[model samples]
Target: MPVESSALPPADTVSVAGLIDNIRGRDHRQSRLAWEIYTDIERIHALTLDRPPELDTRVFDHFANSSALLGAVNHIDKSHADALVNEALALVHRIPLTGLCLYDGIINQRQFQLLVSVTDLVDGWPSAPDVDKQIAKDLQDNGPGSTRRLRDLTKRAIFAHDPDAVRRRAEQARARRTATVRPRPDGMAHLGITAPAEDAQLAMAAVEALIAAAICPHDPRKKNARRSDAAMNTLQGIPLVCQCGREDCTATPRGAGMSDLHARIVVHVICQDGTLGGDSHDGGGPDEGGPQDSPDGGPGSEDPGGDGSDDGPGDDGPSDDGPHNSGPECGGDAERPGFLDGYGVITADHVRAIAQRPDAIIRPLNPKPGQALPTHQPGDPYRFSAALDTFIRARDGYCVFAGCNKPAWACDLDHVDEFNHDDPAAGGQTSAGGANAKCRYHHLIKTFGEWLDDQFVDADGRTRVTVTSPDGVTIEGRGHTNEMLFPALRTVRFQKPPPRGPTTPAADDPNNGSGPRRTRTRTADKHARRRRERELNRRFRELHDFGPPPDDRR
Candidate 1:
């Protein structure tokens, strides 16, 4: 299907395309208005070029740093204001055809940004001089798809033009890999790492591997929480413990400070009947619908009193002493890709590598609710009970505040309505429906910044939350729903499990990571089930089921 006209945000909605949609709200009028702003932007760009040569400022620097100037004029934030000026500088100076199209609001700012990035991507290639024309021509002919699709096209074209440039860049990028820390408001900090493309992909693969290997479907850790933990485990060499007997898992060392940082990081992976879809069960095929055919054996299949064993194939689940992926036979799916929470999808090889972890552990959690229970729990006071917290975490996925990606595990679970301590009749009861996970930062924002958050169950059975800023801007998002724990793995067929080779980590698995690769020689899952069963048995024997001993401790 084509990119519909309305699929993209209106030019003025996020761009400098001003008030054009105000008149009739017709498609043509919106386009005209977008083009009007685009043309004005071009005019400004041209005017900037004619500035006296005596002035030292380059047109590029002037445009790039003109966010304040643009913001002052457009009445938007500095970031959005920069979009207007940068769009003009990018399109008019490089690809005029794209500039013209934007002038008429043919696409949104995101599409324009995609084109800009593609142009920059090919700029250093051997065919750099002519690459712009070729790129514009391709967009003119093929029509842009998603940003990723556009990036792929750009890379392919550049690679075809000069494959050596691609090789050279790949090698050169290795030297650029480094980690940095950026501090945020309210004592929060962001850690950024840039690795070579392969390592970067594998790193994300590790995160997905950790999530899949460590987190069960019923655990309340939102994807962001899982992702944060996964990244920490991968880079920090942390060891994940299996809490099989536990029903809920929270990020550990809650109040630990910098001084308490240890050489070993601990990860907690929870598994339940719903988290590990036992291989090739009666689910018919991967795509087969209905809870009766759930990938992880549906809601009620969980063992309330077991170590996630006897749930069938993955009973052993994950173990710290388990063998790794990338050996003679890739641990699981070597071709299928799993999702990297908060980022994108990862390759099967990456998935396998994570599963092969010597520090990975798996445990079982109680079954998740298949549908909404009563809005509030009876007789519960203070915060949510463990059951209600688990239910809410599985549903919301992350902090309820807007644009905040803090994981639910790291957040303070709060009631939407104030919990009544003084008057039970006047105060809201602690229940799944009224509970939300908000990090301390966002919690403050909601309490003092006049931000509001409301949650409701959507038609698809997903619990959706609407967050409104003090300025009254509201946006909606959803979290973990009644979907399978591993949707990508469930929907996409993996390779047929190969004959077991070594019961140890691959000497050179892209590092303890893994997936189920499919084959036609036999039912893809037949091998998958057998392989999982074998892994579970081997690892389960070594599991303390209680806990592991530390270097200096009992």
Candidate 2:
């Protein structure tokens, strides 16, 4: 009923490039090919595991060397390779081929199949040769005849299998996996539960427990009781109570008392709508047996909620004993004598001139009463001002640490010399001198860690600062400073200027005619005379026909 392959067109007749092009075009075709190869490897892995105890190493070696099998199939990209390898390895470990053949004595069939699949996927037939050699060497060193008894034991363990025993052992493993407890937002603990499959009853129980643990309030019609108590009643005889106090307080309250109290406190503190706990007034109970009256009558009151006038004093206004001052009125010479006296009233235009005037001197608002002025003043006030300006400009660079990019303007000017007398020698530099801009954190690290040993010295031999590492390494000196720490005014690489236009040649014979081309003078005139004397000896030898020089001399 079916057509014979001999009657059909040969696959070789189709171009290999065309075949590849066809495969590339269809996503499903590529995926199917990859999965087919993966499934084959999985089957091969299982057969290797099911073999007799003594045959595992030989079987595994064959799988590992099967590079031809792996490379023959396509879809060897990162994602496909990873997924296939992972799935195969998972099965191998589950059956535990590696454990039985190497370290652990027990093995599961499922685990063996998985491992074989992974090994085949990773190492194809061509790659298998190297794996074979390695395995053979390991067997030679650690097989039955090895000097180490433990090595032999390990070898036996890697090949052994026990399907039922493994399954039983996995029970404890599953428990350990599920034992982890995650913390709830309300500070309660919850155990994670994972089953072979989802069970509705179990899931519902977990949900019910969570709901019970949560402090949901009861309906107002039900006297605003705890939801835990209501949930307990819903689940009859399922106790939900404070679980505290002396022996006899077993009456379940539906939810945990502690959780309820905590939830109540949180609601009271964080409720933006101002609805939880109670109304704004103290005496507003839930059931008062009458329609509640609004605080400002039935919605349309002329009182405008409190008081109508915007500026007028209300219930919360200042009392007589408050900071109310009834003082004399302003603008009168008699009532407030010196209100306008001695006050200079200058117009806005005059401000600039007053500020720029050479004779302008502004006194300090709160100068020390008896403090004496400095006896030895350094230059004029303007010179001092200029020095300050220069100091600010020079120190405009950011915190001077490699990779630290803090701006200098944003930092504090730290004194290298401490101002306090008690720790005079503490900060390194002398008193009343030396300061550098540093951020608050860096300043603390420098000061407390006593890292002033690290410093940058300027050309004048003045120590700028030092930042020493905790490891006792000193980072100091001038040119070695990190440029990243300082603000870069310009980059270091040089740029060449653009070429100029060609100059026009001067017109020939237009003026006094072309001048003679200048010749370069030689500096070896004396040397030339010495060279001529040397050449005379050679000329004389040629004229006299002197005998040939001795062989050794020649």
Candidate 3:
């Protein structure tokens, strides 16, 4: 179909529009290539430096801006661009030089302002999987305060200054969050001690002592077992009493201590027995052989007592019998009968309630009250004493970690090696031999994480501890050693390097300074200037299109 000449725009106008479209396309392609090159730079840099390939968006931005200078070189010859990149790489090879360059690259006046805005609003850049990339994209598209904002002003400022500083700040924030505190309505309040995170641990020795004290008074083997049981039950607010007594003696009320101790003892005893039956269940009874006969031909009967025969004392006299019958049972009515039918029976279920309460104090039933303490067996006393001494020294009268001040005496001694049935390598003799102490929280970490591998062997053959932080720092002794145990306690300062000068081309060089190098620089500067002009024009056009300025001509 032939188009009318009047309907179409002028040829010159069409050509201009085409030229504009071509320029836009070229701009888009160049921008895309620049971004790709930036990504490549980052990947190569991270790999070469042995750092994590994924960097914070803020770090990426820093590198991107620095590489923008390279974009300027793109306008010149390829050889010049290559030289600039090579120079940059060479500088980066020196560790301190790289740090300084990255710092300079990220912290110019414009970058500083942007970093502050981002950090102030966003809280901080996230370090999770793919998060930094997302954050960078959002910052570019929507600017600060957007949904994808990554950091607050403070964090941004810190990051722009030094990435390590930002990292340290983040770690401190996390530690503050996890630090121990009193329970509050909103959550744990960041007050009180900051001991290692842990569950409350109980000492077996303390538990045993408590249990013994509680139950010793009511022990059936005691002098006045019935009276003591009644007294204990009264103290403990329980109904437990000696059924051996007819009075149903309810004098002493049971305290938490008495009830708990009794229950624990009962359970312990029953567990020892396997079946719930008491010591009586283990047989110590007479043999199955019939009773021995008397030498006097007195009633030769199966029963220990004679069957109405009077070969010596007219059926009532004692008879001379074999060794088995020598004990008075050979004569009439000399055998003692089994326990009476009406004796009381103690059941395991009766004590179940008291056994499970955490606050309840347990006691042993048979320990001698007010009696001299038993001498601890040789190896046993030394082991326990050594462990206790180590705990006291390492903890230094309080929790070793910063901000935690829990008294060492109040803390429980935790075994570094958990006593578990699974993982035979961690069980029995091997684990027992490897035991080291920690408070409840550190114990949990060791049992549940990589802290199990963190150990220290002391001069006395006792193993201490080592803690590896998330940042790959290894802290030893829990502050027991001379060195600063926490990164927070240490200070890091950086010194800026001197500025670089322009490079001079050698006379022998094939390409003169005006060759590829000069061309690249000139082209880059031209592109930058063009971009600036375009941006300014766009802004001005928008302003003019929106409204005319107010007339101030008086």
Q: Pick by lDDT: which candidate is best?
A: 1
Off by over 4 Å in 1: 1-32, 48-52, 55-69, 76-83, 103-106, 121-129, 160-172, 184-188, 234-238, 242-554
- Candidate 2, residues 1-554: lDDT per residue as tens digits? 89999996698787655555565446434433433444566675556454344555563353453333444465365455445544544333332223223222111223233334423322323433333333323322222221222222222222122222223433554466543678888786655555421122223333344344532333222322443344334446453544335455433444223333222110000000011112222111111001111211110111111211111211211011101001111111111100000111111112222223342221111022122222111321111121121122123234444334443333444544332222222222211124444545566665555444233334333333334464544333222111211111011111121233354554545455677532222312322332343345335434663222122210
lDDT of 1 by residue, 1-554 (tens): 89998898776666222333333246535544665666677676566554454465554555644566667777889778777776666665655656554444444556667766656645434476455555555554333433443454455455435545555554566567788999999998899988633345435545555555555665556777767766776556665443334646543322212212221122212122221233322222111111011123222232221111011211121111111111011122223332222222223333334434543332212222122222223342443333334334433334566445554444556665444344333333455555566666766665556555565544434454556554544443333321222322212111121233343432553433555432322422333343344345335433633121112211
Give the TM-score comparing model 1 with the true structure, all chains together.
0.37
Q: How well does each candidate superpose onto the true structure, as a TM-score?
A: 0.37, 0.18, 0.18
- Writing each residue's lDDT as its tens digit, candidate 3 over 366-397 gives 12222221111122321222212221222222
lDDT for position 285 in model 3? 14
Best by TM-score: 1
Please estimate how well model 1 matches the true structure, expressed as its whole-model Cα lDDT. Answer: 0.43
True lDDT of residue 336, candidate 1? 32
Specify the poorest-scoring 10-residue window by lDDT in model 2. Answer: 265-274
In candidate 2, which residue ranges exceed 4 Å CA deviation?
1-394, 422-433, 453-456, 460-464, 479-554
Instruction: Find the 10 residues in a row with the least total lDDT in model 1.
Output: 321-330
